[model samples]
Target: MKNPFARSSRNGDDGPSEIYGYRIYMVALSATWASAMYGYDSAFIGGTLELPAFKTSFGLNENDSTSLSSNVVSMFQAGAFFGAICGFFFAEYFGRKPVILGSGVIFAIGAAIQLVGKISALYVGRIFTGLGIGSHSFSDFGSITASTRTFRAQAQHSGEFRPRWLASKNQIVKAQKNLAWVRHLPVDHSYVVNELAEIQAAVCQELELSGEQRTLVQILHECAAPGVRNRILIAVMLMLLQNLTGINAINYYSPTIFRSIGFTGTSVGLLATGVYGIVKMATTAVFMIWIVDRFGRRGPLLVGAVGAGVAMFYLAIYSQLSDSFDRVPPSNSGSQAAVAMIYIYAIFYGFSWNGIPWIFASEVLPTRVRTIGMMCAVCMQWLAQFIIVYSLPYMVASIKYGTFYFFGSCTVVALVFAYLFVPETKGVSMEDMGVLFGPDVSILAVKAQENYQEFRRSTAMAATEAQQEKQGGLHVENA
Candidate 1:
């Protein structure tokens, strides 16, 4: 009873070890680009919304400003909600690649609409952009999840299983014992009894499968790979948290915030907002390539949260100082300090919290549910954005600068959330993600790895048996 699934010892050395590789980096880079587009679309409106050309053309007035802003922001989010709903269907049907490409096209179209609409003050253009962004966000989530899952699956399939050199002797002994057991199994037992015993043994020795059983083992492994499912849950949770950070308030209200800081000119404020977008893009790129892989997810999140909180606190203080200056008619120095603090706030925001959260949201989820989860996450995020953007002007007008303190407090909460819940996934393979999250996290990933091992063993054993048959044939010919 020779084992048909076992491979020769030589075949065991063909796989590679786990370390960061070029292909994996490339995938991450592509996903990062998708996230950048999301940031661009999201933040661009904040600057452009304030242009007199935009305002007058759109029939915007100070009286209805908050409502108008809310409508615009919320519409984008509303479109996103529908897009996420669509992602669940598309991701399952079309696979990851097509959905992502489609998303990009949709997003680009949305941006294009905004660009065209800006000229005519047509609300239709803004709505079109919102539709694209919403749809694209859904596709982006699916793509990132699929890409990560594929990487993990490939890694597990081609990964080396390097048992210790000292363990080779033990392996040999174990092989001998296994062979002995195969030989001793009763060949003349009652057929039914023997069959029943074999079934029981197969169930018991689930991890140590036989050569003929290798196919089943491989199937099981494929089912267990980590990236196969649960991505949606993680994506949704993370995205929801990102929205809760209140960064959208800053994005949607940048012009007003600048004005409050003493930048009286509309053109200056708009220019500053554009500069903010550039800073966000540049800083996100740096974080993705150098910082994300180095510091891990939690560190940046915490650092960003704390830094944002401090900045917002300064904003609140600056607001109060300006009010005092107005009352007391203080020197120009106080005004200058207030203005500098606002710019400082923007810089800190661009560097720390704004872009990084979106990246984090993209990376953490498992493959099967990634698109659905991302859509859910982003939907909640946009909805939150809508609320904050819509409410901020009124809050500022009614409560003065006290709204800054509220946002700063929320940043502290975001910090705590990141520290407690978010795992560091910096360099971990997608296949191994199940192990990191928990044993039950990724059934597909775990199963996939197991199946691959079983398939390898089965193929090896089959080859060995074929070689042995050929040798026997040669011996018979000589006789």
Candidate 2:
């Protein structure tokens, strides 16, 4: 059979390719390890802090232990905030691969330092680790998704794309191989020819409209462009909302949350918390693989907000009615119900809010300023995370069951945010995002996708005809 991407005398029209496919998963799995590492490190502290041995080893049970534990738990996030800023400069100077490699090395150094078994040393280690993780996270999450989507989308429209981080010959060659892998074809294939032509046309059209600017200062200014600015707003809000949902409260202080609900003994609380992790892992897998692209980002976020809010509301009401005013209640049917509610909340969270924010941020920004914009957004995310992590212990102590109410109210507001601000990005090309979120977008309009897609196709066709005529004239002259 003729290659689907080829013209083959059939008028070069195969329509737009599928927005997502197996190739995306293959590329994502192979490339996005920093995301997984970040999750592993973040979750490790939750169960670790609960360990009696760990407490003894770190002298965490000594005087002012509560404050100490909070510090230990929160220090990483503090460091991550600064690390995100460092990431912007690192990417600016060194490019993407060096950032990845440097982040890994720094994380390893921090991990090794933690193994020395001294609390003072661990504190220093955690900061370095946080720095590494924070630096790695912005580049890893932003580049893999944005670069992949932008590359593929541009590939579908233009054919060949020069990567932003082609610092050397080796990097350029690697990028070409990666692109070929994403296309699931040999580099020299006729399918590649058509794709390259289309991509070039799109690039040409874009160039005619704006001059290229490569300076870091200029790119930083580009971050203020209306389309980029709006996306940055969306990304920051989504990330802030993500933490405000209180996922970190559950993650970092699960034993405390579990104990507050009903479960007695560290083992019981940890066991229940272990179950929460299992459920999260399972459901997150389902969402990441199946629901995200199929169901779209906005819908799941809306459903997750309402469902999680309801679960938290149940927990709050249960705690209020069934428990003592000053301390945690004993294990009863209501506490059991609260435990179940926690599980339910996890289900809602795992299916949507957990993963969608990163995806949204990755797709929303323009390629030139994507890393800087994401660095700013990820900094906000870490700041939000730090606030929740550092403050939750105090909030739970002061307000008791009222903490759930606080989180629940936040989720309710999140519902409004998703409905009003979150755009459905499924199947939309990166090139089209500016137009999608452009000033002309009407808040009342239900679907702007079809209208804008038709416009892009018409423009692409005109650019393609111009390219073909140029190539034809060159061929005749050479002959």
Candidate 3:
């Protein structure tokens, strides 16, 4: 496809299709609010704590606020970690639409709890918000078949991208119905028939290879499966490294980050932090629309690591040389440059770690265990994030200039990791993920496509016979 983000109807065919339509974008937009809400609060608590009014209301002083700040921020991450784990399980049981809607409702309630102006109430609210986040959608392209997720949020809305899952459950009719509806084709249409046939065949091959029931023991065993295990490892490592980039450190404590680089005054630090957020927000859009697919995952990860690492190193140097927030409110040119480096870092991060890890993690899993595998991945991400947010305040308080250095070094390591381990997933088919990662299932997919052809032929023959019978009956009645 011209937009290689989309897959062609034919397997292994990288041609264009009409699938990348508006409905897809709308559903993508709906899932976005989770991350949007999550990000807002990750940045919100720390910034709010910096406010003189907030401190007064919360019974805290600015000088002794690090513990309080960490508690507030870390609580959210803790909730998020657990919420994400449970969300995946529930999503598997109930489906995505409920999880998506429920999380929003939960977050709204949590947000309301925070408005009560009491610390205990605030903590509970933060936890509620965490559950609502349940782990964010890793990438924008959730399902080509699920463009109407937003519409589903309305009346009678409960369908998602579940072809393989449905096929695995042997619900061939249901899978066919869904695929036909999503693709705007008849159930017997070649595109719909072919897709369902391939999906069924893939599931069959998976079952034959595993030779195990969909039991707890077997699911656990597949975790150690040759190809599946390696992809899981990659996902775990990527999630770990995603947080090691210190994006959350900036996110949770941007005001503190700005101050460490010699910017003084609450308003001044917040202004810098605001600009940093703006840069991140804008760059994220650019990455999603064009860079993610065009430049591909590996290139952005490598380049972003290089660029963001450089920016971090600069901030570290600036933090070391400057008066370290002892300067006047306006700040010096070097201090200004440090602020600029944070924005520079945001640009790189937004383009790279902000979304790539999630995308890659989602892409690498097999169909059957995709939900559980993603649950584990999401847990790792939140666990790492929780650790970062909980420790960053103390890291800044104790290490001072060393905080930037620590994060800067992580980026260098991230650069090496991306270079060594990350595979290029752009324009790759789902079947190819198994081949690329561990199991060489390309032969299986080929055989499956062959089976799909047979299925199509048999189906057409059956339809022709049924039509013939109908015509004979009509002629007899007329006579």
Candidate 4:
């Protein structure tokens, strides 16, 4: 079978060799640990906070324990929210590679501090970990000393992508060279030159459209501009709706809920959780690799949201009818269906809400404000998560079935938001994003755009070849 990675998806581009594909995959594998770790750390930390020794060490009684536990677990998200904003400004000044390294340092220090086994240590550690995770993050929950071998190697391998994004302040000056470096082409290669021009045009067009100075304040100001503000709002809303999908509710609540549904033993609950995670991972990989580019983002999002919403609604209805908060013997069809719905939610959420918002946010923004704009979007994401996590317990306790209904409702809203607001970015160019959002571009238009650009480049290349031959003949006649 032919390797997909070896071929270019974009028109007028090629040479994405197997080695390049492998390297790109490694970078994603290493640096994109934040999303996975968010779940891992929350689950582990919830257990940690519940440990008797941990409570005693913190000098907490039951009354204060719940409050303190909420605070401890939520501190990470709070830090992550601010960390994203800080990382953006930091990334702007320092560059991509440095911010990435700094995030590791912060996360490592945070992870190490938590081992001190004090409440203070936990607070600081989680905050730092959150900061690390705010940017170029790989969340390693294991021992930091041992990490020097494994995660460090991953980080080093991930660093190979540095040239592709490191030059922030001087992006234009270095764009051609960076493009050539990644594409494994000479700077003069037509492919590299053409892609570089697209990038440059994108940057220039954004600047011209905004007519704003390239400062942190000015960029934020530009975001308030009519066109930019609406896109930013869309990104924020998509991210917000993503968290509202009851995915995290399951992340934090599933053990208890699953046990309630007759998976009562610790081992059984863990096994159930493991399977859920596996399902999410598998489906998400499928969606990202096979579905995303082929079918486009909107269709999968609508489909997944509907599936998840249906699952949530089913659980809500079952929770009401079965009254199965207390564990029963593992023999009821209704209870099993409730339990299965959680996995079903994971499958749907994993494929859609789990990944699409981030992709949409990144793709919709232009280079001028992409860093800070992403900062805002990511901040909104973490803040939404923190809000959901902190409020979820009370919500589950107070509303019970309505909790699922709330998430289910959000999914319905997400469907409408996607249909009306989210433009298909599948074939859109960065430079044309303004137009795509403003005038509304079609998914099919990307092919036309690519064809036109290819023709334009081919014409330029042909003219250059003819001119070079003429010059060569003139030099020979003079000689």
Candidate 5:
């Protein structure tokens, strides 16, 4: 198989035919900028809270600081909760790119508002930023899946861009060009014939099973597919586990975590967090491009869960053994080790729970319910995140090192969850999900097998035709 990351050669013999090319990869990468910004903002909050100027401006001191900091983080999450609620409308109205771009704009404005140094402005700004971030939650991996399926389906049907309805000739040509770019095919490439046919076949199969005339309510609530329900449950479970692991608690309170580990100076804590941010981004990059597909989702998640548990356990133990939460550690080694363990936890998180939930949710759902399913999953994610962020300060103040104990326990549960429920979605195409998760795979498996067989036949037929044409040209030249 040709490597999916590389652009297909013009000769058609150089790249993996089974995978996609640069265009698709570019689209996938572009979509992740939303996630990147989300990480940046989450990390930014911790560093900002550590700023003496920020604390003084907000009238914060050690006595009332934890409550104020929690409020700031919680407010962002609260805004995100409603933003997820509204994302359905935003996506339907403006589409994915617009929603993401708009979110970036809103987030930027919120950041600008925060620079003004007032609590009211800061709360309002955080809400706007949350709305933007919440809006982006819908545009993650699922958005890429939807776009790929739709573009391929449309390109297959529209062939050479004959004007449809009110669409102009220029519009038709532009659409054709764009679709060609996405598929990494020349406008008239013969390869598109098989690809389109396969997409159309899968789509027709789904419509037949799902029906074309059902009302939206019937589609969402009345459908009875054990596989579909199972898939949705997996997504929800993953999202729940993601928040329960306390990754956000760490992201939203890295300075506090650092402080608890005995970093007395705010600058020192912030500097350490900046390094943490770098590690997170680098790990996330490696996971996205290589690990997720290569290793599959379940194993990494299990490893990550177990790894996080160990790290959190160490942190919890070290914190418990320490003299005080607010004072510098009597021995720097234990505190330094605790800080290192946080970095280790981030490594475990980056490769697993960080983005796999979105990828799995997108991959596990059939086209019919993908939008609604993703919407609900993201909403749950934001809501869970809100609860975690809101409660973290209290958890820290009341229980101290016990916060890590709670998250460590959740990681153990997460391992079980992954083992029991999470299916391996590596290299699975969007349309084949029904077959993968169907009530009786023995029956549904044939559908995918038949589709593959048909695709193979098409490839062979095209190759034969190309060979014949080449031979005919040789004969004509001799004559």
Candidate 6:
């Protein structure tokens, strides 16, 4: 049987097909939401730590501040690290949805513990939150992979139908040709020529048809074979991109960022931090609704890096100027400027980097490897987070505002990496993506369309040969 969706190769081979847009959007949206939660959990602590009750209760001091901060902040990353490590095994064993749900429960529990005012308990909460984020990250990637695979399968099935449909239409044309043959029966050569021309035209139309629909038809005919290798590559690239963004650094050190922007008073700083969390959550909600679908993944990422870099540079400059002037209390104008920069940073970071990386990471891998790949990527991110959280205060104190310069520099590096490597996957389906990006598969999904066309041709040729053989058998039977 001929697959309708397969496209014809130049050498007459059939290939995979493309997917529709709506299906891609639905999968990406669901996967991106998981990332939003990831962002929320990572950033929520920033504001809470700024609360005076939090400070006095913990007996924080300048000398022990960094250690205390690291102790509190690092737990989540530590949990995340372990979670990601464990996620690989669970995702592989249980599938994506269950892992995501499990993560959500962990995150909710962590948030509940923090809300209850137990400083020690907060660490336990952070661990659970981290675990959830890590596990969910893997699950999300798996979901996208599954979605892409489905799209590819659909396209392939569509390709298989094209040839059969065209063949059915040709049956009508062939009937016309037979009638013409009978009408010109007295004119032997003329009747034969006309009949052949009609058959040829029908054949040509079948051969010429190509596109995603065509490839789907071919795959259907071929029994919907899986495109395995392409799925792995997509997962790997997603993992790399998620870590390369440096999102972890920003999430881990948002409070330090608030302080650098002139909110040095612990009370004011913590309040601002909580506000930053609200902004992150709010912005992520907006992104899930409006931006993720409209702009594609790379646009928000580039915009975010630029925004973060500029804010960091401003903070760095302000730090240097304040230190150089021996300004114990900043001038009102200077203070206002710092506050404004911090807010801007918060808004920008919230909108772009907070939710997008998780979304991209989750949707890029296939079901089979989604868990392992997500785990690897999330672990790398947490490790990066651990470095930033553990060392940020020391760097800030030693270098003063110069620390901002370093972070700013890192932002530029992340931006460059994003532009060069990230692909726009806003509306790509899971299954079709498998064929589109599979190892040695064509990146141009149109190739699947071509594959579909080729399959149709083969099916037609086979059907024709079968018909001839059947006719020969019938003649033999009659004799």
Give the number of the best model, judged by TM-score.
2
Clashes of each: 23, 8, 1, 0, 1, 64
- Candidate 2 worst ten-residue window by lDDT: 2-11
Q: Residue 432 deviation, candidate 6, in Å?
A: 4.8
- Runs of candidate 4 exceeding 4 Å displacement: 1-4, 8-21, 27-31, 47-65, 137-168, 171-177, 186-194, 205-212, 326-330, 439-479
lDDT, candidate 6, 1-479, per-residue tens: 55342334433422222223343445446654666776665666655565566677777655766666777878887887788777767754454456667888888888788766666787787788878776766555544433433333233321211112223334555444443332323323453344445444545553554222334345233222345334334434444444434445456666666555555676666677667667666776676555566777778878988987787787678767777323454557876777676667666776666556656666555433333445655666677677677776667567767677777787787677566555566655443444334445444434643554554578689999999999999999999
Each model's TM-score, in the order given?
A: 0.63, 0.82, 0.81, 0.78, 0.80, 0.60
Where does candidate 6 stray beyond 4 Å? 1-44, 47-52, 55-60, 96-125, 140-255, 324-329, 332-334, 431-479
**lDDT computed for candidate 4:** 0.67
- Residue 419's lDDT within candidate 5 is 74
Ranking by lDDT: 2, 3, 5, 4, 6, 1
**Model 5 Cα lDDT, one tens digit per residue, 158-177:** 22121111121124455445
lDDT against the true structure, per candidate, is 0.56, 0.74, 0.73, 0.67, 0.72, 0.58
Candidate 1 matches the true fold with a TM-score of 0.63
Candidate 1 per-residue lDDT, tens place, 81-184, comes to: 66666655675455444656777677666666766544333355555555555665665543443343333323333221111111222343443333223223
Supply candidate 5's per-residue lDDT for 57.
77
Where in model 3 is the C-alpha error above 4 Å? 1-20, 135-162, 170-174, 186-188, 325-330, 439-479
Residue 333's lDDT within candidate 3 is 84
lDDT of 3 by residue, 1-479 (tens): 26533433443443224333344455556756676777787666778888999889878776768788778888887888888876766666666667787878888999999999999998899888887786444222244113322222111212244456567767789889876665555688876676677677777888887774777678878888777887788778888998998899998788887777766788887887888888998998777664576787888999899999999999888777774744443466887787778888999999998888877877767777777777777788878988898888888878878888899999899888777767776655566565466553222323433444554578689999999999999999999
Q: Which of the two candidates, 2 or 5, achieves a greater TM-score against the reference?
A: 2
lDDT string for model 2 (67-99, tens) is 765788788898888988998888867776687
